[model samples]
Target: MTHSSDLLPPPGDESAGALRVQNLDLNLLKTFNAVYAEKHVGRAALRLGITQPSVSHALGRLRLLFHDALFVRTGGGVEPTPRAQRLAASIDRSLAILQAVLDEGAQFSPATSRRTFRLYMSDFAESAFLPTLLRELDGRAPGVVIETLHIEENQFNVAIESGRIDFAMGNFPHAFSHFHHCELLQERYVLMMPRRVAERYALDDHFVLDSTVPPALQFIAVSSHPQSTALLEQHGLASRVRVAVPNFMVVPAILYRCDYALILPRTVARAFAPLGEMAAFEIANASTWPVNAYWHRRFDADPGHRWLRALLIELFRIGTREPHESWLAIPPNLRPSALNP
Candidate 1:
């Protein structure tokens, strides 16, 4: 929808001509983009480092200019109208292009520049990787900020394309040829049990499914990823699964408090092992999956994005040895590193 009045003369002048492109303020469009991204005035203001009143003022101008209520207040937050959604694609692309052009010659210095990098990752990755990465950033890039968002598998590609998420880290089956990716690590499934259970059962480096253990031990199944459950079923351990949880983060506590054992990724199990209550054991047969860092190809040459990519690669580079501390009492060879170089 076009703005009703392109050119504004004196106030209350019905003869005012149409507005021209030259008269538009790019800052207002930028504000609109922020609001569109966050869908809340307060959050958008925080994102843009502006005041809520300013954001509200910008939205008002946008509504008047477009002759449409671009957004409406909702119980949870602001919801974009259909017109806003239609305008968003072009507006976002235009702003991105303008941003790219402006950043063409600008050098990115992480140490001094206050740049916020957003990433989409699962809780497993957060538990495994954030400590080391944050430590590195504290020393090398004091002014840089890092924000992690939960990965919604269905919208992963769209989030990256829209610049809502700078990087996505996980094992995704679909190939995004239009995006750039670097393998961060490869992981296989492992059975994690409380230290007491491991010691009581005399389970060493690997757990062997047997008549003595299969029926007696309770299995904790994660509903988010069924691959692990499927593996258990293939191994005829499906009947043992008594506790089903929606997320892997809850597995550690569940196993610690109960006699249940969890089937999880090796890296995730290792991350939980250091809590001093859990121990990881190799599964009888499990397939490995690669965890990768994905980003839009449009940012391949961006200085800031390039720096961020390098930082992630450096911190998560495939290593010959998994971090020794992830395993509680497991032997060195049995302990898999989170990343493989």
Candidate 2:
């Protein structure tokens, strides 16, 4: 009888390159990670940019090496066996550590590098964060490319963790608590209205929402901003909603046409203030939301990612909440059923 370690290749073969780990190839681990993340062999092959048959062959090799089924077929795709689940966190952590070590030696010159940094963000975040961000990048890192994906909120953590997305910028505390994050800025909810509407309601820049409520101060709620609506409801003003729209793209037009007071983030509201279209005033005791930029903990050592995040911090960060160094939480999302390639 021969032992499994006997078949292992001799250590320190330069020809083996970075792909060889211990004795086996790194591609096997990558295949396993992809399949584990995707929950389907076919999707994993697409994610790894390989054929399905190749993934099946790799799975066969993995089964023999581990002496476990690892995964079993399901009606829709595949589910990990108890053994695979046990091996997953260890494999993922090992891979992340190795990648971090490799990144520490890599040099990234923003002026000359052509790496495209992918991001996941909401439409509101796109409008509020991108203009200043683009201007900052224009001079310092002109060669850097940016691609933003307005994906589902639940998908962002998994995407960033897998290195599919570099960062996620938004007011999403619930989704990013498991990752490394920085508070880029904080903004309080504000009551915004056109000059005419403000004047008509005897509202000024010093206006605050208090117990002596004005009956005529109705509200316009953006569908994307439920926080504002919820605030109104909390104040027993649910019936005060006069209009609701899908997003902020049509906000200015609506603000100009209606007398409804719009409640929103002050940073976004200030953009319209300078245009003289509307003015923003702080809502007394209203909830404040932090705009955050989040990335996976594994990228903490990546030079390019670090540079980009630093730039964002310098350009917009106002709060002192530093990035946390904990990997205590995993991405809490299932692969969306429609995420088939």
Candidate 3:
């Protein structure tokens, strides 16, 4: 005979549902998530870095608010009720989003950070820079992770704009106003060939093209950069090019096995020269280019991006002791003119 509305709690009553929501503490929800994961009050307290009594007190308040026993004791541990399980699913997602929001503004600490940086690089850049960079990282930021993707010149801008690539390392001629860039080094081209090829033809470090070597020398062209091949064609060396490979890393092994010669950046060439099976020589009329690190302007003020940029600049900047020391020992004639006084 009574109306259903009369069964609801009276307005402004302390026990009303609105009062419960208004008095709800976010900290209690955090405790709930911990207990939900651990399934034991004592272990949940340990996970939350709080006392066991504190977890039990919060659970009591949660039970009073929900009007149900959210967890029940079992021989193994505590088990969640049907209502508790449903609450846990929503609570977990909400906490994850909240944590992400907090992290977006947090200060970056490379020494303790487990952050993974995504990079876009050419095989040439990877071969030249990764060895020393990895060693430096091991000594400085042991927890940081670096993942590299092949640089696709055609899709480079799109990737950067969409935030798919955190940084791009290579020589990109065109600069975008919407992006930021810092020149790491000036690089020039060099021709690399096997030690046996130089010994077999009695070729000097300064190779001279002649009727005997020009026709017989097999040129190994990398397909990533068209400019390198164009430079060879410009100098009338393209006709002898018989093999075209996609990666610069493979050029060294191929040169070691055959009489193939590769035109590569000086830094990349020097990195492979230490293998004891190949040699590097300055190529005549080779083009010089600036290697740079590119990032979108949206990350200009991001502390993490700034840290990464500064790290790269410190390691490879022009005139820096680390990179200069390695290439300075090369004869002045063999060094790039851009690097020369």
Candidate 4:
């Protein structure tokens, strides 16, 4: 990587003043950051809401200012030069700081703000959370937009760090470190099955591979969360799984069609319960986990982010704390006023 000192222009040279960053336009830096992230001018332009020619023009100006090619054309897309790699981190951080400073001087009113926040969620969480969230937003922050994205678990850190997503909300079984999160609610898995299938099992006993369960109890495993599917394999019932789905959207249809039970969150099962075609039974002593809303520490003070978070807490976190659940223990130093006040 090119060292930072290598970027310095010759001292006392009259022509070298233009190379200084303070003289650089913020738009050039924004374009550079977007290009560095996307590695393609077309994609960078799309991300920045500008035309491809405009992005190229900004890159040309940035190259003259930095005196480095910064990005080299490749067969697929451009790859950052060593100089660009060294500068990218600092530039991104500087941009974030400037944005925060501007936000501090500005106020965000939910009733009027038109900010679009990207939230990460699975189809399961979306089905359970989005309707209620959108309903509340219609009454409170009608102009604020919520765009939900399906991001893999491994990409959560990168998504939040790059400002691609505003929040990660779900039933996360483990904590993702170096972030702040508050428990939205506690959820346990339940056996959601055809009413006839549910009638075959006894709800009072713990869920076992072989109880007084039906002789034809086939399983419809939802593959979105491993724990739900893993519970079946752990009990040596993998061979009994008749089919697998990627999400909960089709579970209700499958339950009505066959003598199958799906292991899914109680919150989702609760929604299906009112449908009357199926029955949801709690698995006694089954694994339980907390649903949480996570955000980066860097965005802890932004007004719109805070307002949306406050609204989420109001909607999901009801009643007293459950005893001895470590994941429910939100950090004491978080923005308490937005959450509790």
Candidate 5:
């Protein structure tokens, strides 16, 4: 009887020119990655620019090469076998390396590259980064499209591991060992309220915390992560939650409709201050949120990935410097106001 390892080729096993010399085809590995990503052979076929029959043939080869069903059909969809699940991460990394090599000489001119970047970010990050990033992309990569997936902090690792998201940028205190990280920006918390409230109470005046208080401030809590929720508790303000929400994009619109105070990053509050409907004041707490760019280690060396990340870093750098309202726990006369404000 032959052992399983005997039938399998070792890592990086390949002949110079013959596909038959090795039982596995590198092209089939690409097909496998697509099918695993889509979970449907038809969609995988379209992604690989091949016919459905060809995809099926590739899947058949993959199954025989590994001597496992690889994908088992159930409930009108297919699920990866245990072996296939184990092979997934390495296969994705390998394919990326292979593709990078095949196109090593190509230029990564963002202006001409029509690619869609799927980014995972919390609504808070989106509110802070989107406006400036969009403007820059319009002038740089006009045809590059962006799609965002709202990520709860805990779901970040799984999202990046599955190759479903290219990057996750958010304010979370996470140390992901499997991916690369860069600090895009750091912001302190601010208390934003309507103009009337700012006038009624001084920044130093201590306010009582209560659940029954009328909705004096529209507190926009980002519902996706415990970290955002934890900020208030860590600062002894958990009982002050009057409004619970999930997206920062909707905060401005909601604040425009009512008088509400929310705890947000100074940068974020500043970005929305120009809307002409609200004001922002700095909270005394020294808590900070760090915006990070996270990508899988597999793509760390890929030229295209590097180019896109560099552009994003530049965009974030320029956007965070915009002048706006300053919320500080001090008298207005002592604060340095924005030059334009």
Candidate 6:
């Protein structure tokens, strides 16, 4: 089989003449960087808000330009070839320098820039912040588009480190250290049930006891968290999950007309409360989860990235305090600070 190096056009070949003689399309470098950063064409496409086919097309062009496969699929998604790996450091440096030059020129304006900013978030984030954020962006930054991307915890750090993503906000696991993080806020987990159901039965058994509270009352769960199960067992309630939904949105959507109770974060509950008439109660055994914003150091000095980060911080501020500080202020219903505070 012919390897990538063998595919390089000859020094004087007509195909190589144009790229050598004239202006090279620097956009190709962005494509190359994305591929290198994500190590997967599919993910790079999502990051760039393009199609997998487009990423593949870009890779084909990059392969011809560099005469290297650049990346080859492996047991762990796609891995860069030796030539591509060797080019990474230099390519990153070049990209950073280019971004620096662009930043120096007053070309990017968040208010007028028609750029799409991509974010990685959890389902809870999607439910809590995305709608308001989109409306705000539309009314203010008419040209901006917000793209929410899905993240896999196992591969997330590598993707973040490579500059495949501009920023990500969520309850990221603690082991990821390759990127810089800003504490966005902390939110408490709560119990959600239709107000009617909550009124009919007092929460006397503790948050966890509802599991075996008779199958007459069902339980809806955010399937990913281990705490959901533990919370049930803690109250000596055998939580027999009648329905397990993957996202917070789905939990409330399903519970609206039914008697099922859900365990979720308060931020999520408030967002969906009006739609479902769902009421939230502090989960006695639940602890708050920290939410953070993260970015690769590569974009730390880029003006556009700086602007975007600042905008997010501004919007999340509450009560004249930053989101991080305001998390301590309990909502009116749960105003008494906990001993944990």
Name the weakest run of 10 consecutive residues (lDDT summed) in model 2. 323-332
Query: Runs in model 2 with CA error above 4 Å?
Result: 1-105, 320-341
Over 210-309, each residue of candidate 2 has an lDDT whose tens digit, in order, gives 6656787887778888888887777777798888887777777777777677777766665444344565565667966788888899999888998998
The numbered model that scores best in lDDT is 1
Which segments of candidate 6 are over 4 A away from where they belong?
Answer: 1-107, 202-216, 317-341
Q: lDDT tens string, model 1, 1-341?
A: 53323322346666445657886899889998998999899999999999999998888787767666788888877989899999999999999898877876576888887889998877677777777777778889999998998755788878899999899888777747878888887777877777778778777655555334645777888888799889778777888888888888777667757888877887777767655466666666577878888899988878899998998887786744444442223435554432221
Tell me the TM-score of each prediction against the true structure.
0.63, 0.60, 0.63, 0.59, 0.56, 0.60
Mark the regions of model 1 whose C-alpha exceeds 4 Å error after superposition.
Answer: 1-104, 209-214, 319-341
2 against 3, candidate with superior TM-score: 3
Give the alpha carbon lDDT tens digit for every residue of 1-341 in model 6. Answer: 76545667766777764345144567677787888888888889988889998887777778787766788877766888898889888878998998888676644676777878888887776666676677667777889888877767887887687766778877777536767878767766767788668667754323333333434666776667667657765755435577776666566557766888766666666666655555566556577777778888888777778888887776663432223212322234543221122
Q: Candidate 4, 185: how far from true, in Å?
A: 1.3
lDDT of 5 by residue, 283-315 (tens): 444466567888898877766678888977765
Backbone clash count for every predicted candidate, in the order shown = 10, 0, 0, 0, 6, 1
Error of 4 at 173 (Å): 5.7
Question: 175-228 in candidate 4: lDDT tens per residue?
Answer: 458888888777677666765665566443233433445656788888777888
lDDT, candidate 3, 65-112, per-residue tens: 675578887898888989899999898999899898888766688888
Per-model root-mean-square deviation over C-alphas: 17.0, 19.9, 10.1, 18.2, 17.7, 18.9
Candidate 5 segments exceeding 4 Å error: 1-105, 151-154, 202-240, 318-341
